[model samples]
Target: MSVSPSSPVRNPWIVLACAATIVTIAMGIRQSSGLFLRPIELELGVGREAFGLAIAVQNLILGLAQPFIGALADRHGAGRVAAAGAAVYALGLILASQSATALGLNLTLGFLVGLAMTGVTFVVVIGAAARAVPPEKRGLAAGIVTAGGSFGQFLLVPLAQGLIGSFGWRETFLIFAALAAAIAVLAIGIAGRPRQQAGISTQSFGEALREASGHSGFWLLNGGFFVCGFHVAFIGTHLPAFLADRGLDPAVGARALALIGLFNIIGSYLFGLSADRFRKKYVLSGIYFGRAAIMALFLSVPFSPLSATLFAAAMGFLWLGTVPLTSGLVGQIFGVRYLSTLFGIVFLFHQLGAFFGAWAAGLAYEATGSYDLAWTASIALALMAGLLNWPIRDAPVARLSMEGAR
Candidate 1:
């Protein structure tokens, strides 16, 4: 890979840094919403399933919109899409504040916010970062950007918890909306004009999808990511409640989420760097297996604040660590020509898992009066994800190379 040494040394790094900042701020507040679930349900007089369903809707809508918005960004520019998304997201929060029913809240908070997330979150931001860096450094660049979201998790979860304790959940959301609006400026900086031609013009988006659809490796990657969504969404939406049920303080849940975010900073970077140096599929396999072992350990031990925090920290290291490696593999196998779209397709699988994870946890807990089955299912799925990754051939598929040659 040839390094493109531009006359200016600082420009590339600055662009990457800006992208990271945007991802961090947006993801931090968004991920922290899990901590708000219990408080909101209590104050608003709603059931756990209702709030859970809203968040599930949010995740599903976001997943559905991601590929389309990512494709738009790939075709057009990230800046305008991000700007529009931020505005919609802020408005969703405002509308959520006035909601009198689950249906109203779900439409505003879940659908609108979820759709907005497509532009502000990883697929768009990381795709931009991937294009900004030199070819050889794309994996590291992707890691740096994704790690920003983890950093946001570390900082935002605790902050949101404190805000909720001091003010109220509704007020907390309003404040978060303000913060989201402020972060939109970073999106503007990153939303450079789209590159019209990146040397893969002959291959249309459909062709790219068709190529990936034919490859068994793509399906394996997608399937494994489904497990990833299940793990993260289940924990994010329910972990706070789980802790409260276990007789731990709500703040402990907040801190646990924070710790997961903090440690993932290290995990994402290390895994991303390793992806460049080692086989990405193997690194992905290890991450999924680690999640399985960690979840089992979390459930096996007596529930305590310390055990919960430890579990979160361990899981955090594995959390979103999948992003850099998976995105890197897509880039390696196909090139960055239609990265946002391909990766968005991959994310749809993740969000589908999220929908089930969020909804099932609530339904199961309500019925069985326990989260044990959900935890056990997560463990089993994690192990399956590990197995799925083990067999993926990360090298470029023949069809892609053949098209490139032509």
Candidate 2:
């Protein structure tokens, strides 16, 4: 379905803050998986491909579950859905820590955690934020929540690296489990039920879904976002290993990741404000072009600590900048009536790209003995994504246009 109307939350800012916090906790733990990769491999003797495959599975499952879970949030309330997911998230982390086999990793890290993330991630939390605030503020609100995820990555990735160094991977995971469990308490603070604006023509979920599916712009949005997912998942999951291949220190990779997260905070915020002020499709186009340029620059130079740090900072600022603009376009064109569901479907395409990004990079590296081919593909994909977003018409659907006509 498409974006929906409004909600009855007392203070919209409170809802925005709580939703952002939930995103921070949930996404932070998820981003740290890469930090666990080398340690888990060294300890368990799991090969990189096997681990990468499991991580790919996690992304696929997360994408697959979003539309369904988002629907549940829209119907039942984001708070309840988030609370339940947090329980599952903590359970998944705990079990993942205990796992010794690849199959166990698939079940715990790939499947369960992936499933739980759908409940707490952008589709649910940002959707809640969208409905809670006035329409004019939705882009900034979505950006704020999206930034929370980046902040978490910035804050937690380094913390996780330190914990992994000091406490060991298993114990570090247990500590993360405790952090994930806190999402439930925070979920209680988000908006519970979506409320219809009085006298406004309300759209059913199916109607919104149909409207979105029929729109050409929606599919273009999905296409562009798929590229975003591929870029983000590939770099986030594999950059550490890529740096290590250049004979750099492991801590360097962690710092690079944290830098990406840190810079992304600025990126998400600036992109959010830009979406509000400019043509969202144009903003999205620029982001994709920026990503292509950054990657190209990273490859042209020697792989050194300074270069890697600079690359991460450049890449991070472009990271997830697409979230607010893409989701904003959905609400802008379709109306915020069923935003969670429509955006969830769009997110599925993103996850498909993520699955391939994570898995394909590993396969390429394993077969070619370097990530050169993957790097080549990433650059090409970014250029193509920029093209995809350039022509997206942001006109509202007939339903929304007609409603406004009244």
The numbered model that scores best in TM-score is: 2
Per residue, candidate 1 scores C-alpha lDDT tens digits across 348-377 of 999999998988888898889999989999
- State the TM-score for model 2: 0.98
The 0-to-1 C-alpha lDDT of every candidate, in the order given, reads 0.84, 0.89
TM-score of every model? 0.95, 0.98
Q: Which clashing pairs does model 1 show?
A: 79-191
Off by over 4 Å in 1: 1-10, 196-201, 399-406
In model 2, what is the error at residue 242, expressed in angstroms?
Answer: 0.8
Question: Cα RMSD for candidate 2?
Answer: 2.2
For lDDT, the strongest prediction is 2
